[model samples]
Target: MGLIELPAELRLNIYEYFLLRHTRIKGGNQPNNSHLALARVCRTIHIEATPLLHTYISLRTEHQISKFVYHVDASRCNVVTWADVANDGRVMLTPQSSPVSRLFLALRKMTGLKCLRVFDCKSGVRAPDGPRFHGRVILKSEEAMFPDDGAMARSTPIETYKLCVSPTTRSTLFTNIPPTHICTLRLSGDCIFPDASDFSSLRELILDAVTGNHFDRRALDSTFTSSRLETFCYRMGGMGSLELRDSHLESLRTGIGTTIRRLALVGCSRLTGNGLAALFDQLRNLTYLALDMITVRQLQVGFIRVLSPKLELFKFAITNVSYAQPLIAEEVMLCDEIESLIDRDQPPQSMHLKLRDEVLQSSGRWAKWETMVKHRGIDLRTGVWGTEELQ
Candidate 1:
């Protein structure tokens, strides 16, 4: 039978399967030939698969964007929904090659867009003048492309955002970010001074690699006003302080404002034992906490004594051996106890309760917990606290 001989539904299903299959093989990183190859075999396939192919176009050059816009027409890929533009020292931000502006026009065409991410490439494609994009656009700036294209006015209508860029970007985007639509946000790296307008609609925020200098006391006040915020992730990057002030910590504990449920810190070198203790005192609803590359010495002898009661999952990566040695020794004792508990019983029914209360409760070390949990015949998948709840 000819290519056109097949029913529309069957053809579309096959095209979708191939499109998804190719996307999986490429790790969902870029557009590949599979889309184009399918389009070439028949006119029917080309017409049907154009939207799917244009759904995600990773264009790096002005020429690429212009060509794509011309072929798909401004409306077809205008909502060029999701993009990953890399500023790898290749694209320079200029009036002609402004990446953000081109992206804005592409988004205008995409009336159905929901998420947009921008990475800088050395090629500077200027933001073209056209209809505006009305979706959630995340402009993660790795270069000096902020406050350039009248960005704030363009972004004022977006429903949500996740920004991690240089200082100037915060100033420009904050003014434009609509106060009503934002629900979840992630901000990292120092940007422009934040005002109350910046945090009006935020619900959940993940601040990673944030510099303390950027977060003045006033910004903290505005950003935390989101009573709806339920989760916050902070991945510390060699900044030698907890950077969280007393007011920020107090708001969480009082439950008068936002109640953060999950808090994570990775490689927070400056946060002292007291600093962490103070932060923990505020998270009344905290259920999961993960601290990576933190000095074990900071986890004082009475650390888990106060914190472990409410925590369901805790992860700590021991960076310093001197601090971990004592904990390792304690873990050895717990292991020996579990073995004894198992040997003492005919089938070791008591091992589950013993493992849960003794080993997992006290130590944050993942390796030790893995060893003890497996020894008790509990599958790690089913045994872990939140693994079952993951959708």
Candidate 2:
């Protein structure tokens, strides 16, 4: 049937479901093809989903963010409760203008925001301040866009505040965060502790840092302890050397106590086998434990040998190419001869050897290599292999 045959309620429902499936408020950069496609379906759908499009807005360019501010101010949808700028650390601040100011301007206009995540557009790019220096794209206007009490009033009621800035931008922006009305705070940067204000209302906390040494250890411990958070997540970035102390983990463990369920450590280089074992002893209610970039330690001999059976998910990757030789050497040292390696493991009779041969041959090794793991209950030879060889 054509557009006229469908009822208005049905059309609106379709738009709503489309938004539910496609509208990612927390991490999405912008409306996807589904959002754009829904608008093109018909003029009616366009009007219905326009508000959905505005519900979660992301403006990458300074120009786009400005335009969005104007549109929201004029239309006053007030339904756009989530706004994200500086997606994936691409925000640039100019000598005189700043993305944070632009964000401050846009946020002041959106009074209905319940969740806000601000990220630094400039992450790794560092240039000296000059006419041509590449930094966060700041506006040339020196004038404060926000009113005297505007920032405090609008942000006090915000329910969720997420900040993902670089070390530089974090130092400047978090210098004065409106005492948070937010119950959920996800911070991913370096040394960002909003002034020693009480976050008594906060229940969920997530900390992600590429550079861990940037923050003062003692002061951060005090902040985490004071907040009494319920669910806590501490994720190290891809750099792999981010320091995590037993005291911090213990503080986190003690603060959450019986409350924290899921804990994931990503790219942490310093976590030893003994440390993880000790930490696991404290987590009784912990359901999910994930360890990624365990590239720093020997899994088979070190941490995995001591890991808890309660762990639901475990992941590890290579720390560096330099470790590859040691891994191979370790494996080779255990087996005296190639034949000894092959003879050690025997396969069960029920399995087909040809299938095993194909699996082994994929790595450019001879099919006979299967004998190495055969004794470990893997069947490397089946009746089919004998029949084929007799032919």
Candidate 3:
């Protein structure tokens, strides 16, 4: 029998294998030959596979959004479950502009969209006497684009939303949708910290490159205490450090320590050893932990011992080196401490340690450390430490 003559289940599996790859349509003009070929095979197959091909739609420019709004029919638009809007820092959406109004209209037409990501549109233009987000003009006039009774207002609730835009943009965008419907929220760049009432149903919260100054202590405490957050990750880049003090750890421990399963604090150099130890002691449920760019003083054997008991996977990095001490001696002392930890009777299930390449080159004992860890049936990894983009 021919490929199309196979069982319906088998045909669908085959189509999914091929069509899923083209789901994330990037540029406005790029065409998927495979999708087109499959569609051309037969009318029945096309009807079955077209929905899968339109599952994810990514528009990176205003032109792409415009073209998509005008060209794609309602059926294709309705099947998009995930949509990403990442303009190239050029197109500014001013209030009362026809393009801006049309853009919101197009967004409302995606009846099936569950996840939406909007970011990277850092325009320099400023609107006079208009609403602004992170110093960027988001509106040109006072008229509302997404009215309270519009189609977008009554559309399916968004479950996941990632915003890296300005404060005005965020406020304007959320005006139409109920914040309680959001389960996962990822905020980056200069976006303001979300209000306590904004995401009551949030389970996973990711803050990328967000600084400490953005958070209000009362709001932070409210979020940690009120929301049912299970996984929280805070990542910072460059030389900037998040001002996470002992009080923050106290809030985390008292609020979600028992429920949180995965925790990552990267580039939070302001945290002290005592605070980390106390926090880890309470977070007995955590299975995955990532700590990067923490202060060298916090790398104590007691902290490691406290952390090893519960974590299934641990990612640790040493980025804050003490220049007051001899570099080589400091490296040797740190490596020796790690070696001693590996030699312990019971180590973490898996540990990824990131160190300076120069330190690794100078020390020959890392090879022995790896072997010893392996002999103990522990998965140990070592690599050069550096900044990486958070995807």
Top candidate, metric lDDT: 3
Q: How do the residues 1-391 of candidate 3 rate in per-residue lDDT, one tens digit apiece?
A: 8987899899889888875555433422222234546767888887877667677676655566677779989988888887766533222443532323344556767888888766554332232344553344344211122343343454677898775543333323354455678887776544433354556677887766554354534545465345666787777544443455667777777774456788888777667667788888888777888877555453443455566455677777766655533345555566666666666666667778887776766656767776787698988877743222233
Task: Give the Cα error of residue 261 in candidate 1, in Å.
Answer: 2.6
Instruction: Report the candidate with higher TM-score, 1 versus 2.
Output: 2
Which sections of candidate 3 miss by over 4 Å?
1-50, 87-101, 122-152, 165-174, 193-198, 216-219, 238-242, 294-301, 321-347, 356-364, 385-389
For model 2 the local lDDT of residue 312 reads: 38
- Best candidate, TM-score: 3
Please state the error at residue 291 of candidate 1 in Å: 1.7
After TM-score superposition, the amount by which residue 103's alpha carbon in candidate 1 deviates from its true location, in angstroms, is 4.0
Off by over 4 Å in 2: 1-37, 43-51, 73-75, 87-102, 121-149, 166-168, 173-176, 212-216, 238-241, 256-258, 293-321, 324-391
What's the lDDT for residue 34 in model 3? Answer: 44
Better of 1 and 3 by lDDT: 3
TM-scores for all predictions: 0.57, 0.60, 0.72
